[model samples]
Target chain A: MTTYKRMVLASRPQGHVVPENFRLEEVPVPDLKDGELLVRNHYLSLDPYMRMRMEDVKSYAAPQAIGETMIGGTVGEVVASKNPKFAVGDKVQGMFGWSEMGVSDGSLLRRLDTTHIPLSAYLGSVGMPGMTAWYGLTQIIQPKEGETIVVSAASGAVGSVVGQLAKLRGCRAVGIAGGKEKCDYVVNELGFDACIDYKAGNLKEELAKATPNGIDGVFENVGGEIFDACLERMNPFGRIALCGMIAGYDGDPSPIRNARFFLTMRLSMRGFIVSEHMDLWPQGLKELGTLVATGKLKFRESVAQGLEAAPEAFIGMLKGRNFGKQLVKLI
Target chain B: MTTYKRMVLASRPQGHVVPENFRLEEVPVPDLKDGELLVRNHYLSLDPYMRMRMEDVKSYAAPQAIGETMIGGTVGEVVASKNPKFAVGDKVQGMFGWSEMGVSDGSLLRRLDTTHIPLSAYLGSVGMPGMTAWYGLTQIIQPKEGETIVVSAASGAVGSVVGQLAKLRGCRAVGIAGGKEKCDYVVNELGFDACIDYKAGNLKEELAKATPNGIDGVFENVGGEIFDACLERMNPFGRIALCGMIAGYDGDPSPIRNARFFLTMRLSMRGFIVSEHMDLWPQGLKELGTLVATGKLKFRESVAQGLEAAPEAFIGMLKGRNFGKQLVKLI
Candidate 1:
């Protein structure tokens, strides 16, 4: 293709993200130089961390620059290559972002085996999200057999894998999700022991009921009252893998009211970004890939049809409107 | 002495502690049996954890039972002994509570050498408070040389030792305390790099000024806005040793408003009670004892004369009224 469509960050969001924060434009596909490959992007992974990068803040990553391609994870098939490492029609995964086509030097691209796993699964269950779950659950939370673990955003890409992995480790995996539909999927489909519908306005009661023995470990994604409830019920020396705080990502403050519980329970909480722990990704991906290939791990995606739908899908995902791992179909 | 004065918990505090919560009574000293020693109490240590124990809450320890002798650490002289391990006139430390005399089985008591260290120093610097500081700093925070560490309640018993020890380990020790006097003592006397007076109503600005380089380690004693301010200034992968939340001890809520920082900064926070980590006490106490004995560690005291003064002194100490280690002279 001589030209393609892409979205760029137009402006930084003041508080809540709106459509105006992004700009969709038609641009010429870049000419490939030596040691470069051109990939036709198939899918773009829209995640919570993108919302954080949209703001001008000191975080693990630099802010997504205005008038630049909005940063994201992508799985695509190489269409053309001048690089010896990558070949035409090779299924690959890289941070190709919100574009229909991308040019890369192969350094950032990883050739994938699409025979057992679908190309789309590389953007969800067997990709960064899966590795994130693996690193946080296995390394940080480290729940022992028969221990109880609570995961927030339970039906999403990361939380789903976390709960499933905990179950495999013989843990009582409890989940807290936004709605009844998501909660049902988390318990029935994803194999979580119990799932609490946080929007039911009875989170405290439901959470207490779900976790009678109290929370031994927490994979915290949505940090607010949900996180506070988990903190209140944390067992002595409980571990919290603070992976994300999507509830407060839009400039709203979500204060932890049970700060005293940290002392009273002698809890240990560690916040982490999985990308910084790249050393474990190979081991994590190997486990995740095997689980997905063996059909032991299940994941669902809420795919927006085109590149233009990326912004709205992301905004909806941030508000917990999307049911599962939100993605954009580029082709 | 056949009869001795002792204080007992008469009731639980409604909000803040009052003198009415304690009852001073004259009781006959129990006769020492085999393997027992009678201690003539010299000083009673008043600390923040006592405030939490006053409430019937599920905490690190069981609530101090009402109408029982109040729980406290005591340094005393062994005046009568039927145990082979004890001798009359030996300086010792034990949990003898708010009393003029105590009967111990010698198993709970530790003999002290007061040749260079004062007998009362065992209650403040080289005792539980000092060991608490050592465990939190060395074990949890684990600061690398030249990294900055912030200690709240910096002039108080545990906090003072933390700052001094952090400095000894080649750390930039910043302190947070109540007033100018305590702040000055922290910086000048205890050798903290800088001190922020929370009472100045410019905690944010003062903390920002004091810690130009973001805090790498935190010994959090007084949780509330002070802890929040520190959280906001935490560097990536910062470690927080949550030792106490005295500000919220009197049935008040001390919410952490900067909870988002836990994820953004990838911080690690651990709440600990020194008594629970008996394995570390020997090493911790050895370092503490040698520091005080060699004059490398300096500690001040806010002495409340006589056993009758304990309740008021404890109440005052909880309110940050005591200058340093709040102690009641019982001899």
Candidate 2:
């Protein structure tokens, strides 16, 4: 009998999640039914939004139930299949959770085309995180040519793509990251116009120096003081696309101090979820796929070893310890 | 020489303005130059936005310079004229400041026709304040038919027009006012769907009772606690047109505590100034004028005696002591 390992939510966390909160268990692989397929997960995706789902609070999505498998995106091979659509040895990607194997009826899974792009690009730039960047930039910010855009969490999965896309659209892209290392990577490697190291002192002064023309668009991720400082620097008719506030996920939500600028400068601030706009996914995927395959768009990843490392990797991601898209490579 | 009484800014107030902050002075009306017309002021418009001008801070308009005549809208008749566009004894309206008589170049003045719509209504419902209501409602909220809209400071000039216009658009109008009397007038006289007395206590409960289906649109004038309470009751994808924030204009700006809901609910909030959108004014004025001329839009006034009473009336209006549009009758 084939056996597999999977991680389940042991309990809800109080402040920061601990390893004890997730229980790694072994289970026998069930036989595939007439229309079902058994796939071995090769990789697992970890993101900041998963931190919100860990808590039983009012969020855009429902909380993760206890004893249930920790849900996430995965790319793997169809080792056994009785389904007509997915054949044995076919590669597929979907939300298959933190497990060694996933049984599917081939509904949510997408067949992979590994000829141009790697199998892992689907989880970072050409997948959910990539689509998120696309929706926020195209639908909300929609910065015009020569306009300036400031994106927080600049070296991360979603923000990296946002900066690259803005540059491609003929706009000046400024990024805000944690350290000198990440900042350097963002500016030198990612080809962003400028990258402000937020961890260093005098954030407001640094931002002012970088954006002399005033910020016309903001893609906010880290909420607290960073969001407030960026808001004060916005020009008239500035547009803000609210994405993530990972700074507050483990603690009290950040209090936006300078929202009064909304009136004085006549700003437009909107918050959105990528899942809510499913119609834009196909278009986003097509563009993201082409860019990644053509070597025009670039991405980086910090991968952990196995399913047992997902809890620690996820916790580290919230703290911004991981450099880029935090993924777990499983076999 | 013709002399007139005018209210000038004596000094900037520390917290709230008193009558001492304004000085009533008699100045000899200057001679009308070429293309100039001398106007004998009949009515002066008092609005909340004028308070923003009183402070020497960064705002949409320049600060009211001490010892200068306080800026405001006025409606009057041309007693003497040299310009062919304006004739003697012709009624006119423009920015004539807080003066009983004004000398104009006939450049800014518009001839009034009180045959169908009352001239005072031009200062209240079919004028600048009315255009503010139009631009915010149409451009930001853009509520669908049968959507619920909550208007704060509902009995005042701008807000009264907001509710009346919303009702005309086949929307459910909900008003929030200070006292029972103003609330009664808002519901009984103005034909609003419901009115909440914010002063009666149980504000949360009252707002909950009023907006059972959840607030789809909010026309926010009075920010602070009232705005916080309203934001909590808003439905997903709610749109807020941020106008005046009178509640916090005196001391400190209100801190938005529930701004995180912006992301959870996917809300779109935008702030606007009417003068900035001049292109929409003609369209807005035509519709507003028709509404008032046909008696479809109703308005009420709390007229103060003369230019000397302007400061006291304005202070009273800020304290919610006025029933409707607070005006200073200069004739």
Per model, how much of the real contact set is kept? 0.90, 0.67
The docking quality of candidate 2, as DockQ, is 0.65
lDDT of each model, Cα atoms only?
0.92, 0.89
* Candidate 1 error regions (>4 Å): none
True-structure lDDT of candidate 2: 0.89
Model number with the top DockQ: 1
**Chain A TM-score, candidate 2?**
0.98
Highest-scoring model, TM-score = 1
Tell me each candidate's TM-score.
0.98, 0.95
Question: For model 1, how does the per-residue alpha-carbon lDDT over A109-146 read when each residue is reduced to its tens digit?
Answer: 88899889989888888998898899999999998999
The docking category that best describes candidate 2 is medium
Give the per-residue lDDT digits (tens) of candidate 2, residues B221-265: 988888888888888899999997888677576777777778777
After superposition, the stretches of candidate 2 with alpha carbons farther than 4 Å from their true spots are: A15-20, A57-59, B18-20
Distance from true location, Cα of A181 in model 2, Å = 1.4
